[model samples]
Target: MPDFITLTGARENNLKNVDLRIPKGRLTVFTGVSGSGKSSLVFDTIAVESQRQLNETYPSFVRNRLPRFERPHIESLTDLSPAVVVDQRPVGGHARSTVGTMTDIQAVLRVLFSRYGTPSAGPATAYSFNDPSGMCPECDGLGRTVRPDWDRILDPARSLAGGAVRFPPFAAGTWHGQTYTNTTRLDVHKPVGAFTAEERAFLLRGRGARVRVGNTGGSRDIDYEGLADRFERLYLKRDLSALSRRTRDLVREFLTDDVCPVCRGARLNAAALATRVCGLSLADCARMQVTDLIAVLRRIDDPVAAPVARAAVDGLERIEAIGLGYLSLDRETATLSGGEGQRLKTVRHLGSSLSGLTYVFDEPSAGLHPRDVGRLGELLLRLRDRGNTVLVVEHDPDLIALADHVVDMGPGAGAGGGHVVFEGTPGALAASGTLTGRCLRRRATVKRRVRRATGGLWVKGASLHNLREVTVEFPTGVLTAVTGVAGSGKSTLTGELTAAHPDAVIVDQSAIAVSGRSTPATHLGVMDAVRRLFARSTGTSPALFSFNSAGACGGCEGRGVIVTDLAFMDPVTTVCPDCAGRRFQDEVLRLTVRGASIADVLDMGPEQALDFFGDLDVPEDAVLRPLRALRDVGLTHLALGRPLSTLSGGERQRIKLATRLHRTGAVYVLDEPTTGLHLADVGALLALLDRLVDAGNTVVVVEHHLDVVRHADWVIDLGPGGGRDGGEVIFEGTPRQMLTVQGSATAEHLRRTTV
Candidate 1:
């Protein structure tokens, strides 16, 4: 077998014909600034080629059903193994999916309960909430009930004829509204508030009354349904996924969700809930923390249940080992953060006996505190020691230090990046003159002088989630760092802060919704100005410059690529034959703004675009504002036309911050602004936050990075631990003062990193 996996002449994305050999059966860390082609080389190129080649070995029938991996722009990849990519994308599952179901531990528990419970539940299926026999009939096993918000739906001050129905779909003058207005069951002229008790009941709850509704064509008698009943039937009784996103959002405005009364949020039928093992029901086991659950399972030594119990204990131990001991099996997968979801995905492979596979992790240390990062590092080493090649695209210094081999991908980002600036042991890279090396060698210190608070934003009695009715005050007009371990109440406290101050601007790490057609130009609201500029220069309609409109390439229909589905084969996507990959018609591409075509302009990085528009004398507040914001947020390397989906979590978060930069004297709440950022980039982010504060704004960030904590004017540390052990404020003071504080994990980590 070859000692290394070799790639010759790769040019994916910003890569410039890069070639390298990654050692097999060892841990290799890829390091670079954001958008410097680390992800392009590691994930888009190497992982894609490995998976694509592996997919070819399966039967054609099966291969066609699997996910299609497009061939990377690389020449000759050799000695590749089957690759498993654990990306930062959310572990998206329906409401029925939970930690137990996702990890398959719930299945074993179900079997144990079915066979050993005092009162048997027939079979394993009978213990499953997803199964009809075991499901809560009231909620269909979802554990939550959606009901109409009467206050949001009804305007009692107005009569039916005077627009009493607040829901847009049934507002006055609409067909649905006509039923209530024309019905003889209640007074149309009198205010709904003035109605008698019977009249109000009949208007809201009564049914089967005959009413006449008319359009210009004709009038006809129809059976009238009560307002509440009609709303429930049309919006609540059916699958909301089938509705358009806009419709679903509108419906949600008039609806609220709560625990189902029948299930009481357990999601199980009476028989299933009644079944217990060792005096604890299946739901009870699921609700216990993984760390606690392991002890519960270890006690079950009954010969018949031992194997299943052992299997569950093994899986639960892996979860606890990965520093997720606080998470319960019943926790909803949808509620997990990107980092939490990524770690959970890693858990399944930990128990696998498969060898000679390549495991690729995208920022495994992303959401972890410095203390937990060592645990993640150990996990990576374990994977490497199991005769598998482990590759990580990471920005954390600690994770990089754990690498047996390091490949630093840049001297700068975007057009300036792609070449291997340094490839050696971590010790050598630290001494080298590369950007990553300089960042590693530089020591961060706490702020010498902290800013005084202009006022206080108080969050009192914040008892949500894992919080313990804690009251805290966030100082206004200064930068505050909310530090905590994973599963702590930092997110919950931030939620309360935002709820208390609804006008605050929030820039979170949630993925930006994007499609093949979505780009930075569209997302930052600059596409219209760019289009208008092009149209005015050529004296054509603005639509003529839009790829989604008249200017769309006939061959690709604005997608820039033609996807061909082949029966029993991998679907292929190729650049359009008509307009190349410009996404616009030939004539549209011909139109230029100061010698640069629309496609050419979109292809420019933010810095390049800013320069191009600056030379054209575009108004600063109009087109230049957003471009400057992007550049200020350290995203100068990002191409305007690049799909938002292709960007990293840090880049996306920065993009969100850039869009909201114009606000002044406003409170800004940011969640993990440094996610996916290089060490050097964190400096830039800190500078930006300082600018926000200097310009008279209050900024509070939920972060785990010690540098952010060190630089913060005030630090609010939550948790000496996570979950139940970590809701109270352990320390609240300046970073310098936190160094002397005891028991805080954040404080300890901060002290360790301080020079």
Candidate 2:
């Protein structure tokens, strides 16, 4: 077998016809600034090509059912292996999907209980919540019941004639509302609150009465249905997804979720719940933290259950080894953070004995504490040691330091980037004249002078999630860093703080709504402004400049690409012939603002766009406001028309922060704003936070990067450890003061990073 996986003329995304040879069966860390084409090279080019080729090896029947991978824009790819990409995309499953089910540990536990439990469920399937025999009757194994929130749905202060029904569809003047308002069985002028107990029950639960609901057209006799019954029939009983987006959102506002009364959130039938081993039911085992579950599994001495127990323990230990021991098996996968979800995906592959495979990871260090990054590094090295080629697109210096080969791509970002500036060992790359190198060599010092709090926001007796009734105060008008290991209640505590202060603007790493047409211009709320600017210059309607509206290319309708479904074959996508991928009509393209068309402006980076508009004498605060905010977030190089779905996690996060910027005197709560950022970009982020503080905004950041903690005005460290061991504020002081504190994981890592 060849020792290298080679690629020549790889032009995927922003990559500049890149050529490289990555060593096989070794760890290669790809590093660069955000949007420097690191992901384009490692993920889009290498991984995509590898998976596409592997997909061809299977029969057409099998391949048709599998995920389709579009061939990347590359040439002469050679010696590729089957790839396993563990990306940062959230493990988004339904409410029934949990940690145990995701890891297959729940399946093993079921077998063990079926064989050795005191009162055994019929078979392994009988212990499975997804199985009809085992699932709870009330909640259908979902463990929770979503019911109508009567409080939100009804207005007690209003009479039937005055919009007693708070739901929009049932407002006073609507057809649905007429049934309640025009009915002679109830007093129309009486306030809902003033109604007698019988009247209230009749309003909410009465049925079988015929009522005349009329408008100017005519009166029709219809059977009167109770409000609760109507609501359940229309919204609750039916699949919420079947409703329109607006109706779904409205329905959600009037719905409340609670634990199932019959199963008490155990999600199992009585027979399954009765089955126990070591005096603990299968549900009990599923509820225990992974670390605790491992200990419990080790004590199972029954020969019949021993093998199953061992297999379960092995999987749980891998999860623990990856620094997620705090998570329970029953914990919903939907609630897992991006980092946790990525790690869980990694856990699935750790037990694989297959060799000669390419393991691809997209920033595995994201959402991890500095202390846990070392463990992640070890896992990568282990993958290499097991004779698999490990390719990682990373920014964490500690993780990069563990790489056998470092491939640094960039001299800049976007148009200015995509070249492989440095390729060598970690030590050599650090000394090289590259941005990644300079950042690695630079030393960050703790703030010498910290800002004093102008006021305080208190979270008192907060015990939500894993928090241990912890009370903490976040200082206002200062940049505060909330540092903790993953699952150490940092998010929970910050959540409570935001709950108390609802007006606080939260900028988090959660994904923005993205589609083929969703671009940086659209996301930053500047697309409309840009359209108006073009419209004013050309004396045309603003809609004429919008590809989503009047000016769309008739062939591709504004999408710029024509996707052709090939039935059993992989779907083919080609640039639209009419627009030539510009996504506008020829007439629209003919219109220009100072010699630049709308498409031309859309293609310009934020920095370039600002300059283009500035030369046109466009007001700075008009279209340029969001552009300035984008530039402030270190995304000046990002193209305005670039699809947001194509952006890296860090880039998306910065865009999110950019949208929420420029608001003064308001509390800004940011959850790991440094996620997906390059080391050099961290400096820009710190400066941005300082500006927010200087502008009289209270900035609280839940972060794990020591650099962010060091630059903070105040540090609130949570966790002696994660899960049950964490939650209390282990240290609360300036970064310098934290240097002397003991027993804090954040402080320990801080001391290590201090120059």
Candidate 3:
């Protein structure tokens, strides 16, 4: 067997004639700023090849049903093992996918209750929330019920015939809206508030009352429920996250929140809930923070229940060890912060004994406080010591120190990045003076003297789960870093701050819109400007330049690709042969701006487009000015027309930042904006932050990048340790003062970087 996995002349994107051999069963970190070939080397080359080869083992029929993996270009490989890449992609599940189902520790909980409990249950099935046998009759398995926002439904002051309901799909005089007002069989001129109790109930909360309507479109039969009731049944409490932004907003306007009457938020039936080993229901155990849950499970004394419960306890312990004990089991998967979601996945693999496996992670220390970095390092080491190859694409110096070997990828990012500039032991790379090395060797102390806040937004007695009686004030102007290990209540704090400053234009990477039509252009609102430019280029109507409105190829209807779901076969998405993957008509493509077509303009990277459009006099609209500012924030490497789905997490965050730059009094709160950024881009990002402050905005960032933290006007460092060991603010000061204050994880990290 080969001693290592070998790659020969691999030419993945941005990778320059790369040849390297990674040692077996070691924690090898791919470093060298963002834009370096680290991700290309670890994820694109090694992990993809291993997964692709493993997929080839099945028969043709079976393979056809799986996600097709095209072979990566490479000469050969030796002693390769099946690879599992637990990337940081959001475990975005519906209301159904939860911690109880994800870790299967919930399965053990079911078994524990079924086997031994205060009251005998039917079987394991009797203890499952998903089981009809054990499920609450009212809410099915979901713990909440959606209701309509009644206030949005009717203008009680307006008369029935005077267009009282204003919501879309139920506009005044529309079939649905007119029926409610016209067929109360009451006078159309009377204000609703002056009507009898029966009229009031029928308008807002009564059950379906069949009625007849006559209008411009003619007569129609209508089953009329209160407008509020119908809206509630359709939108609230349901998982509407997948809908378009307009749909989400419209639904939100008409929806109200409610708890499930049957489940009472328990999400389980009486049999399952009653059967508990230690008087704690399965739901009760899951509701406990994983760390606290582990302690409860260890107290079980019954021999018959010991082994099964032990497995469940061990699983929960894994969660605590990886630094995610603050997360409650009943928490919505969709609501999890990205960094919390990533570590939650890592926690599952800690006790795993699987060997000869290749594990890939994206910035595991992201969103972590400096103190929590040590705990994250422990988990990564545990996986490596288990005889697995742990490959991480990272920027944190603390994690970098744990690597047995390090491969530095670039001198820059985008067009200027992707070359292998250095590779050796972590110690060697630290001394070699690469961008990463130079940064690692320097530290910026917090200013001994501090500026008085232009203003202060205070969160008082803010108790949002795990956060106990916390009160703090955030500076209203200038850059501030909320430094805490993952699950340190930073999100809770931000949530409180934004609520107090309702008009503060909140810019979070989490809330960035996701859709099939969304791209860097749409996300930054630059598509409108591009359309106008196209209209002027050929003197054609602007409709010809819009894919949503017109100018799409007839064959594919402007989708750029024909999507025919194979039903049984895995979905295949091939480039549209008719449009040649170009997405626009030939006539539309012929229109030129400065001798380049609109398609050509989109194809240009941000850097190249900067020079092209710099002198072309683009509009001063919200979109164009922000697009230019996006290019300024080191996004020049990104393509204007690139699909948002194609951008990495870091790229998406930066793109979100560019869009927020134009907002006045905007509170730009980014979560680890430095993720996937090259060391070269850090300076540019800092400049952008400075620009935002200068533009009369307040910027608060939840970050782990040392450079960003050291330069902050203020830092709130959380965690004396992680999970139960962590919670309160351990240190709060400027970066320089923070470094001298011993025992703070942030301080220790700043100290190392200084030396």
Native-vs-model 1 lDDT? 0.90
Candidate 3 lDDT over 1-755, as tens digits, reads 56788888776667767778888898888886555567777787788778777777878777777775544545665577888887777788988777757767788888888887778778888877787888887778777776555566667788767766667777767767766766655666888668898777667776656778777877887776776666656665356876777898887676665788877888888767777667788788778887787888898878998898899888887777666777667777777766777888887777677777888998887666666788889888888888888888887777898999888877876556667788788888878878888866664554455445698778888777556677887887878888766666676677777888787656675656666666777677777777886687678887887666678777777667777666433345667887787788888777787788766777787667667767665766644576687777767777777767655667777777776667777777766777767555677788888788877888888777788877788888766655555557777778777877866666777787653
- Backbone clashes (count) for model 1: 0
Candidate 1 regions off by >4 Å? 149-165, 169-246, 615-620
lDDT of 1 at 378: 94
Question: What tens digits encode model 2's per-residue C-alpha lDDT throughout 152-214?
Answer: 888899998988898999888888888899888999899999999999898888887998887
TM per candidate comes to: 0.91, 0.92, 0.87
Query: Candidate 2 clashing pairs?
Result: none
Cα error, candidate 2, residue 336 (Å): 0.5
Q: What lDDT tens digits, residue by residue, belong to model 1 across residues 98-197?
A: 9999889899889889878878978999989999989999998989998899888888798889988999999889989898899988889898889999
Q: Please give the TM-score that candidate 2 achieves against the real structure.
A: 0.92
How far off is residue 208 in model 1, in Å? 14
